[model samples]
Target: MDIWKNIIIDKHFWAFYYYCKRLGDKIWFQKLDDNRANLYLIKNGK
Candidate 1:
């Protein structure tokens, strides 16, 4: 049971880490046009 719990936690941590990495790449590496940038800002309340 303890080993299964650890595996589940590790999976969740990696999933969240990869998700943030992808989002960071999208925000930083991709060129955002005016419309998309505006929409992102609006969506994020920034």
Candidate 2:
């Protein structure tokens, strides 16, 4: 879970989070394997 915690606390993540918030996207980061992550952008409500 430390890896996940690291991701949440990373500065770059907060930047992206606010960017998406401004654009109205519900952002998510999904881990794929051990070295990569997939970013998902979803519109509000669904």
Candidate 3:
């Protein structure tokens, strides 16, 4: 399990999003407020 905090940029967000998607990993986005969010990438079996 890996987590990223404060992913507020579009490019950074999409980069992580696509990387996880291509790897077939589970990705989660949690909005902390109006201008902040967290990104979670969960690898299978780990």
Report the candidate with higher TM-score, 1 versus 2: 2
* Candidate 1, run of 10 with poorest lDDT: 37-46
Lowest summed-lDDT stretch of 10 residues in model 2? 1-10
Kindly report which residue pairs in candidate 2 clash with one another.
none
lDDT of 2 by residue, 1-46 (tens): 3344444455666666666677775656443435677654434455
Best by TM-score: 2
Instruction: For candidate 3, write residues 1-46 as lDDT tens digits.
Output: 2244444557655666666667775656443446656445445444
What TM-score would candidate 2 get against the native? Answer: 0.43
lDDT of each: 0.35, 0.54, 0.55
Q: On residues 1-46, what C-alpha lDDT tens digit does candidate 1 reach at each position?
A: 2322323234544554455565644332222334343111101112
Which one wins by lDDT: 1 or 2? Answer: 2
